[model samples]
Target: MEGLRHAREELRPRRREGGPREDRHRRRTRHRQPRRPSGKRLHRLRRARGRERCGGPEVTATIAYDRPVSNFIDKLSATGHVTHKSYKKTSVTLHHNGGRLSHQGVLNVWKTRPASAHFDVDASGAVAQYVKVNEYAWAVGDTVGNQRTISIEMANETLAPAWQVSEPTWKNSARLAGWLFAKVIGERPSTGNLFYHHHWSSTACAGPHMDTLYDKVLAAAQEAYDHFKASHPVRVSNTEPFPGASFFHTGRKSPIIAAMHHRLVAKGCDLYQSHANADVWGPGDVKSYAAWQTKLGYDGAAANGTPGETSWDKLQVPNV
Candidate 1:
């Protein structure tokens, strides 16, 4: 009996030899599993994903982050910081000769003082973008006006008696202004959504030079608008006619009809079928007008077919 007990005890320790191998197998399986990324590495991955989705560099690398803020409160108050409460710019306001420095010198001045403007027009008519379109800068003062306006400062010493905005400066400013107006207001520069800083504030910004070259700036603006219209023509209806009017007599060349025809053509409306020209208002134009009116909830009756304030309002035709 003692010999059998001794042999059994010796065999018991050898039987437990498989425990080490089982533990080693578990350790290998744990090591092979993937690890989760954390900290700065994870942040970088998330930012790259965002850049891919937005079709451009992430906001932090763009003009959105380069804007200057004086304090924590100023940073908190900056526009475009929050998506929900973001400011929607509606108009482009022009300024000239206020900075008392040439366009080339403006950058140096900005570097020292940290002033911000949406755009700066140089004496030679070059344009410099200091801020992004989606954010607001401290260019304009009136709180209400600033919220709705995008300011473009032109390099000129307007206070100086000899200062005059050069032709290149005027042309560039007009072009930029027109582009912003078309993008925001859905209207061309000729439609007059572009305004001077003086219009919004008591100070003369674009200066006296703007007064003389106003027509030229407007013409350049019109060119920009034409380009926009050609690239992105919008469809328009013309059921509405000028108020206090019956059937437009084809004999008299009505300005209202002319304006309507021009707008329709700009919008890519098929005018070849009607054979309506700008010089004459004719019965053939009625179908196109009626279609627009019907879209605007006016019945096809002649009484309702006549263009009125409601129709004009719906078409958004300027100066009807």
Candidate 2:
């Protein structure tokens, strides 16, 4: 009992303000990181430590933001999470994985969970397709959203408290979403068509940083959609209306006449030698029209060089 009392007395001084042990403890902790409060700050510190241990925050791979069509790798997931039924594609749903996961990492997770997205954008912006866009992906946690939307899962450059996505990931996502919107839905991404996972579900999927940048993403998507539309114009049927017989009078210089000449030449009825399919309704135009009429099983007055509505319509003259 006496020895225990003596030991307690010796340790009591160490608990005092200016004790020897407390001084040594202070010296040891002076150069060390300060004790962080148990809240968002501490959570971030732990996340930073984990990030450093892996490969630092920044992704090293250099993938182009606007990659070619061949760059889309198909790393399709198992059929368990994908519904084979085709659905009407109406919107694009953006998401953040909430952790630093690679293209394959996201797939691995989906294997266990009953969740999957159509596409996964890695930290370097490399895209891996998991499900066909025509089919439904078991994402967005809502049946309506999953059935109508093409979900894109993006990798985070940093972990939670601020699940920040890399610049490449977001940029590539915007361009890809734009291309998809244009090709599938025939419209630019708008608030009505483009959505976040949280928009339909109970989770904050795109995170705070990406949530604020949805407007910028929509802008970028619109630009890409416009470029795509310009590059690939819609093909309309080439059925021009018949311009009537009075429109083809002699000495008349109209683009309609030039178009008719070209069609005649294409149909092996060309007799133009000196005019070279010019817009003027000269002897060449008459000869070409007479040949076209003859080729169309016309005889005598019907095969005359005068333009007729039936033969003119049969010529399939294109608009100027």
Candidate 3:
């Protein structure tokens, strides 16, 4: 036992000559300032934090859904976040990610968060769809707004305090908005139908850069919508042949007149005021038809309110 004790004592660390807590007490550590991260280290740290904030990298799995539109590059279904109930989309609500989020980043975020947008446009103008257009995306901060709107989330090319999208992103967004206005809403692109996220929510979404360029973007969208309409005109089949010119005379009451009125209004020749378009012909119909005739290069008497067979055929009025 003594020999064992001696061996253990020899294994113990020897006390120094100072005798100030050197025999058995633990040494106290001196406090020193931490070194700041270098530029590259800071960048890496920011990137790592961003990934965490956006729910890490992109997910490969997705749910089965119809690909209604062909413009998008791919789809990452936010099925967990969206409402399965279908909605009648009346307008489009635009939003910005408020950070430098990529297409996959936006999808990744939606996977974990309870919120989602129907579409996300990246910095390079590539589009990624999340929630289906017919369903409700938990965006816009309001239930009615979500039910009525097709929400679009845009990625920032420049990071916040600026949060500006790239030129290609803006152009592609405008193009997408135009297509939606024409095909989805079946109406012209206007401020009434194309709305910002701030319109419904209390937050300043869409960012400052987009807010400044709202009018410019709206104008571009209008132009693109016009182009889309011109390129893809509605092919309404004529179920009824052109009635005689006398059929367009005053006191005429027929479904054909109402159909013609609708067609004329669609062609941007609306002259109705104070009353709805009816089957009975009236001064409004005359004026509207005259405007249509003028648009068809008719002049003088030829451009009179009377509907000519050539103009009537071109109008492509549908049967009631």
Candidate 4:
């Protein structure tokens, strides 16, 4: 019995041994890796630019944070902070990791590699930040290019001919780029500002998927930018109460549409016959808008219920 107790104690690892405790823990933890949350998950990011459109419910960014990649003195990037004209960020460059690595797994690589980026998007549409907007991230393997552009690294679904990213990842990347454009450039995402890593590196870093789907991504980004602006409305001197397009053709509901409805009612135009609520842009709103246009002296096809620029201006839905 005494021999059995001594044998059991001998097998137990001692803390005073020359080897570190982590060595033993590493061996023990090998098969018990930490699990990432499953399914399509979303997390919101609170940035300096997110403070706008504070009243009512607004669309905040659904962003996730991985461990940061680049750290600097006083929390600055390679050449200071990101800016409209400072970083030259003339464009948003896309790249593929060329492997099916997790977003966090890519971060681990970037920690030691000579290159890094502002953001990394995984196959599941999860985004991880390796560098901040205020600092420069090494993309395209060039100093000048890195300083002049914003980088988004994507994880490929596979290697070779398919060298592609999942649909969700593509959408998330486009949305992120669009969000960045609105926040930093103060403009909508356009083809002119969307680019590929190959544009600088002369290598197919973005892979065939981006090569074939660049246009689609740009279009998606444009939609996202428009959606962001719509959700975050600002009352300007030229603010159009009907949003950008006509309420008649509008398929979505907005405060602007509600305002348009109230104005149509005030103008004594016969809106929809059902007399529904303001949250929806129904046939009534369209019919009433057309009538309002006619009252404003827009005749013929000019007042076809569609909000033309002239009628939109004349409707005079005051900016909220």
Candidate 5:
């Protein structure tokens, strides 16, 4: 009896009578991230733990944020607690909002639910994030998939497979996926690393609408990536920049040279003399380049049909 009384006394805090107890769960451990409102689109990249993992391919091997197509971290007021210790994000799983829900609608509903997702694309082409990229969120309703995938909830115009999202929404989602694949994953969508919610759960989650738009969305990701690469053109590796000399005169044969021909063709140059999409620098390539040069106010030797930095910049030749 004495030992029990001592234990109780020791455990009791020296607080005043009727004092209020602290509520640990209600503590303000959350803070809002700064929002930038300028462009029609929004993109944000916030790295945690000083290490950013790759998502898919479209960029370098060590994937970094290459101006995410529209990475807006429109975080919800409340997010679920992380349920796992460690996770490896291997793929992107797409889910439908199940209906035409707005961004706020999803956030408000998710605030009380025991669930969250990395991103959500609404019918307005708006992207709202409920979870951080470096942290895990309650999605997929399974262990393996949830621990190994970034979940994306795509908003639909209707539940129908034919009208999965509004044209803008579909296009924007594709652009977002492209950005994620490049920034999060290190490659484009392939047989590996892309999935529907149905792939993980028994429910027809993404529905026929997503099923019909799956491939198209993937294609848009590719197009978005290509457009990004075009604007930020990198030098073709192992290939020297055009030396301000004519390829026809030097008889240079190189794959980079062939890629140049492709760009010239795309630039509305008549490269019939050169085999369509040929890699080697041939007389046909020179003829086509000469025409492009002439169109740019060059005449005679200046229009000798050789690639120059100015012309190349405007050509938008992809780093193939």
Candidate 6:
């Protein structure tokens, strides 16, 4: 019993000493100052991470604070056709064909017609920019209002069988329009800024498709504007090669992949396939990787296959 009591007494002091030491350590930690954010800042850090994952340039342009197109400084340049004239600038207009022209035939019409617009968005979602935003085109005809408004012509052949715009076409047009709205209005285009051709004229220009796509276009524009505002620009690699790898042969080319390659090339990535290539990812992809590696000072002779962290990092794939 005596030995046991002695041992307990000896251990109790040690336990007491340890408890106070831990408590003092925790209290000191609690009183210490909090760490500040890094030099990049929280928002910038998020944007940088997003760019790393998306493998593309971070969208940075937005229309949140932009001025309306009418407020643009260069709205008096009269250089294009003056089709139909109007006197009112109260409404934004939209238009579509009334079975008078085919999708492929629009170029000829625009060249020969007295009227032209700022944009011609095709059913395939391919947009052709004809007139500059600040220039006065003959699209709306009336001399007084022609210089004050922007016009867009949607591609359509018929309005029967319930007017419908293809998914790709609608989405692409919405994106383009949204970009234009931001550029002109100094803010993203909204439902208020969007209008149909028939809204200003007695014609059914945008056709039945406009009814279905109106809300969608507005929503898409808003989404794009938000994304643009939250994005940032960062330096990215322009290569597509991985070391010690072989290329895979996918028989079919994905349009999205081809589009990605084209965007990369436009930003100075060296790709083997020309813009006219069949959108296929193959040896051409290897060429792109090699080019990126060369840019990054990698000279160890890497080939195309599954891209590695080095290549992806260079691509600035957004981390999101």
The lDDT values for all models are 0.59, 0.77, 0.75, 0.67, 0.64, 0.54
Highest TM-score model number: 2
Tens digits of per-residue lDDT, candidate 4, 149-179, equal 7888888866997787766567778888877
Q: Write the per-residue lDDT of candidate 6 for residues 46-152, one digit (tens) a residue.
A: 88789889986543232222211111112222323543343333324456644433333555665555566666655434455555555566665555446666776
Q: TM-score of model 2 relative to the true fold?
A: 0.50
Minimal lDDT window, size 10, model 1: 61-70
- Please provide, for model 1 over 157-220, each residue's C-alpha lDDT reduced to its tens digit, 9 standing for 90 to 100: 2355535665546776777777676665566665345778777778766777777777887888
Worst 10 residues of 4 by lDDT: 65-74
Q: Residues 1-320, candidate 2: write the lDDT tens digits.
A: 99999999987844558789888998988899767679988898899989999977633232222342222223343338778778889999999997988776887787788888878877545577777786788889898888899998888877878898866678778888987887787877899998889999898789998988988889988888887777755344364445446556677665667788889889999788875538889888888899999999998999888889899888887744
Better model by TM-score, 2 or 3?
2
Kindly state the number of residue pairs that clash in model 2: 0
Each prediction's TM-score versus the true structure: 0.48, 0.50, 0.49, 0.47, 0.47, 0.44
Residue pairs whose backbone atoms clash in candidate 1: 97-156, 239-293, 240-307, 241-307
Residue by residue across 1-320, what tens digits does model 5's lDDT show?
99999999999988655445443333443454567644434332333222345453222121233322233333342344445344656778778887777767777668777777777876545566656564567778888888888887877765655535555566666676676666566676664677878888897877776677777777877787666545564432433233333323445444556677777777788756537547656678778988888888889888887767787666655443
The candidate maximizing lDDT is 2
RMSD, every candidate, angstroms: 17.8, 24.9, 23.3, 17.6, 20.8, 23.1
Better by lDDT, candidate 5 or 1: 5
Candidate 6, run of 10 with poorest lDDT: 67-76
lDDT preference between candidates 4 and 5, better one: 4
Kindly give the number of clashing pairs for every candidate. Answer: 4, 0, 0, 2, 16, 40
Off by over 4 Å in 5: 1-77, 81-86, 160-163, 226-320
